[model samples]
Target chain A: MTMHPDVAVLARYADGDPGLDEASVWSVESHLETCADCRARLAGQIPDDTRALLDVVGAAVGRGIEAGPAPARRRMAIRRRRLAVTPAPWLTMTAGVLGCAVLLHAIAPDLPSLVLLLAPVAPLPGVAASWNRRTDPAWELVAGTPSAGLGMLLRRTTAVLAVVIPLLALAGARTGAPLAMLLTPCLAFTAASIALGSLIGVRRAAAGLGTVWSVAVVAPSLATAQLPVVLTPGGAAAWAAAAVGMAGFAAARADLFRRLNSAD
Target chain B: MRTISAAETAPATYAWAVHAEQLKVRAGRHLAVDGLDLRLRTGVHGLLGPNGAGKTTLMRALATVLKTAGGELTLLGEPVSGRGDLRRVRRELGYLPQDFGFYPRFTVREFVEYMAWLKEMPKASIPAAAQRAVERVGLTAKADAKMKTLSGGMVRRAGIAQAIVNDPQVLLLDEPTVGLDPEQRLDFRELLADIGVDSCVLVSTHLVEDVVAACTDVVLVNEGKLVFQGSPEALMAHGEQGDPGFSPAERGYSALLRRHRGGAA
Candidate 1:
């Protein structure tokens, strides 16, 4: 037969003393589980007041377990919280607007595929949506948090692109536009907006870049029925360079995002 | 490995939870918190001011939501400068904004738990800490209720739950009792009193009675500058014998604001 715990160890374990090692405490608890005499010894070591509090807490916990919500419902609630990281309203609205533009392309096949021409700027609104304080209801609370800077903004921007990129790809596939023409410029503009966003504001940068693309490329290309030089295969290298340079700029000035106020 | 408690990491023996030296924060072009130097320790201090007097701006700056345009601000002995310092300070901060926005679909408990995660609380401690905060705010029954379904007062309480979930060293609540009913307001004041004993709690409010009941000191601001900082009794002494208001505290509040406004004009 194994030996019982010493009186001193039992007393220290009962008192939850800092010096008591986990192995000794575990041994004492294991012994008490099977040995009635040791259990009695452990109980005697606990003060009456402490025992009374334990009884009260134990009874309350028992009652609570009986009355608590079912585990299934609790799990569902947890699952909902886990899945609650959906895109903001502005992002949803951007997708909706882009969907309408795609519909416009479908109706007018004779006209140039607005989807390909517009691909560069399609994700801009959604990217802006990810960081816009005025539009987000939880902005005040979220802005005050430690992680409420470029890292979080970029994460949300990635989420927006994750959804928007596939949509743009589908639009390009349907319209028979070259993938590089649509994809490279799209990434370049996104990077440009983010880089400039660090200087001004994300919302302002998106709106400004979107307007410039529309005027400089979309309108001219639409007028002549010829693809803009910037969207041509020959231009892919330039687009790639702009994207890399702007991305570097955005990373360098990431700290600016933290000081961006809603009022600004 | 011994798990260190939050108390050990953030010792309470520090001199001031908030220390601002000539802190200048701008809202637009105007300086909202202009050259304001103040020190706050661990206790409930009421911030009394009129509209547009920079109460919200000061709270926002302290919460690290708005950056200081000029001067120095330190939170919990950590200087509020550079990215690393800001992150360290934010880990120990809890703020309830004036608007207190939320996602309508998030359950009350989810909102608090999300805030705990944002404060960088350990993943294992978050669920239990969030639950305790919800219970403390008397929202146990509605823990599963979606935020949109809650009444204004309930949402306010939800906001309160999130602020305290981290057991922050510096807790800032701007107009926290606005939507709450009289009974809820009383309960909220008690919660403030309880937390005020340990942490530095600065509550900005228009309600004079709430401050008189719960605050150890009153800081009156007017036109983006400190008018007075003293005990409630000292503020009460400012009221004239024949001043017309609901209570002596209200009269004192009115008298002081009026006097400050007069002097500023």
Candidate 2:
């Protein structure tokens, strides 16, 4: 039968006295883990001030939850980051549209390039949904938050791109379409949407741009059965310039998101 | 006469966390908060007004959700007119709009933690702070439940929990007691008093008794103007015998509204 440590030895252990032998310290700590009676006795040995100090330390430890994130917490944080960035139906729309274009390409060879025609407008719904008051529902609260300005907008836009770009790559591969035709136009449209979003609301700008692209460009190319000038290989530079310029303009006019009218 | 130096007057000038002078904010085309001058320091201040009295607009402006249309407004000693000051000011600000929306899929704890993240709280402390906030609003049991599953009152408490999660310097709640039950309202008042100790909390509501019970000061507004601002005791003193309200404070509110309209006309 195991014997309990003497009260005098327990008191010294509680004090963390240097005189207390090392073997005794380890044995007491290990025993206390399994023995509730010994723990209570040791607690009785601690002075009030010492107990108070220990309590403070314990509380502070509780409050931090992480000085350094554990592996499980890191996994949870990565999941949370994904959820926080894209917690809406926008991604579904982006991917679905691309899939439809791919299927339509296989089903209708006479249509020439449904995949190419729709590429420019593919990310519009996504970019719009990222910060729109209607879709997010937390618009007013998010607008009033510290990270609500251009940085947050860009972060969400980038997340949308992160999801949409890969979908575009897959769509391009599936349709035997040129990668540049699929990518640069969508990037251009996304940038233009954000640029004009600062002037109007994001949702409004996206809707307007998508309609304009369909009417002014997509419809004409479809009717003529020839690729539009902008969709041609040589037109990629203009698309790239348009992308950069619009992005710069959007950054410069970042204040628009802060206004009540343009908050969406 | 000696002129007051900038250094000497600075203490008085910086005392207010929210200061507005001739501030104007338009809701759509109409000027909702027009030519209003107000100042608030630490402690709870209840904003009482009629439905179209621009109370929500005023709260929206103080929360930095609406830009100032025409005058000077400062928050935490920073002017609202400049874009540079917004991030700094917003870090110390918390707001609950009259009608707020959430992701619905987020759990109570996750929502509060998300709000803390939006406010840029230290990453390590978010979990503890969110837990504490959920407890403070008495939603510990529902902490893991999805927001869509919560009752209206529980959702309101969750909103309160998120507002306090960051321990902001200036807190704004518009019509916060609308959906809370009687008992929950009492608990919310206690929570407000607790938060108001170190932060400037502005609560805009139509419930006069709540103002009387929980507020250190009462502010009355009409047609985008400050009609009255004083202690609850002082507001009760303004009450006349036959005013059209159930309690002394409500009656005082009615009398003041009448007096203001009469004076304006």
Candidate 3:
């Protein structure tokens, strides 16, 4: 019976018999077309050798694969999913501060110091970002999801804004400016703080960066300036314009968080 | 391309515990699983292969933990693409990952119960369900012990207990008996055989006797592709003489020896 060249080639390949090359491979392919028995032999032997070798190796590394629990990918996914659902305790603290903003307005008739209102805004964004750092996996998952990162950040920022803006309006009304007029400095400071915090967090900067930014800018601006005198009609309008500018900056910071987490 | 409208549905009839077609997975530069097709049904199915052969990757895919880069994959007849479908299928699915760990602080019962919760079992039924699984794995006495306190074998038993807690329809155990003693290994094989009656159990291991003893079928994967799939006897018989002969003395019996770790083939 004529042996298939394919089987002969495989045998030669297995034994590492010399003088077999591309031409030999082609010749075997041609022979396999005409011979069935040799083809069967070649088909059977090749896999047998491969499997025998693999069985040996698999036995060796089997122990390591067994002992290592929790692969990195699964851990990351779980982290991200948990973060998306659970808010940090700091968020609750911020909510408490918002509550205080409301209570302070009712209890003391005179407009509370701008320092008190703007003080919370300065650290709030950084604190929120720090909480996010502790739960990086959760943020990474959210960043991976179909939802836009900007949208998620904006949603968070908007939530804070909802609490702060109303309290600021109440304080603004007590300070004798138009409701929209009172929004300028408070909104600017809030936006600037959120923007600065988000930026520092994205750059992997330390938490103190936000505090430093707050001390350097807001502390000085509030101490030397006479707020009631500065709240003339044109000044209020200018403040409103500045607040709108800062909101734009906050939107950009949100975008940066989305990109960083998505890259992960 | 023709746009086909509804009402032309031809439902699938295969009794597959896991069926996947043209599955693909890419991690960084390596293609872990590429253009793979698989069908696992009834009995214990052993997945055998070398390192980086994609056996673990395929198991993870079947568990619905890793998203396929391409292809149609289903677990227990439900498509694994959507979250809702995955959740429904996951209720019947049990997965023991290759490297599985528990919270060190959790007692054995708590760890298993926590897994049951992840499977979305009812709160009231979790305790009974966890108890049943612990009994099945012979870990009932250790149920109160913290995971950190358990030996390696005990930890593996705990992992098996958690996987089978819900009495899953499709169970994927990646190297289930890894750290077990010979007696424990035999007990695990028996446990798997008993559970294989109604559910499809897939065991990925390098051990051939595990397949010979417990599995009704075997699939050998090599380098991201399937090399062979058949019954253990059929695999042994592939190139044998009349009656597909198997001798106790042959190196081929090494397949079984490797599986049982030098035990009786």
Q: Estimate each model's TM-score.
A: 0.83, 0.83, 0.52
Q: Residue B62's C-alpha lDDT in candidate 3?
A: 74
lDDT of each: 0.83, 0.86, 0.63
Interface RMSD of 1: 2.5
- In the range A68-174, model 1's lDDT, one tens digit per residue, is 98675334434234322545465567667667767887887776778778889988877877677766677888777787787877777777787778887877777
Question: Which DockQ-derived CAPRI band holds candidate 2?
Answer: acceptable
- Candidate 1, residue B44: lDDT: 97
Task: Write model 3 residue lDDT over A167-203, tens digit each, in one string.
Answer: 5565555544465445665566555554664556432
Q: TM-score of chain B, per candidate?
A: 0.94, 0.94, 0.84
Query: Candidate 3's residue-wise lDDT over B158-262, tens digit each?
Result: 888878887787888998878999999999989999988867999999776677788888887766766668887776754434222255212333453244333
Off by over 4 Å in 2: A1-75, A78-88, B1-13
Q: TM-score of model 3 relative to the true fold?
A: 0.52
The best-first sequence of candidates by DockQ reads 2, 1, 3
Candidate order by TM-score, decreasing, is 2, 1, 3
**Which candidate number would show the highest DockQ if scored against the true structure?**
2
Give Cα distance to truth, residue A149, candidate 2, Å: 1.4
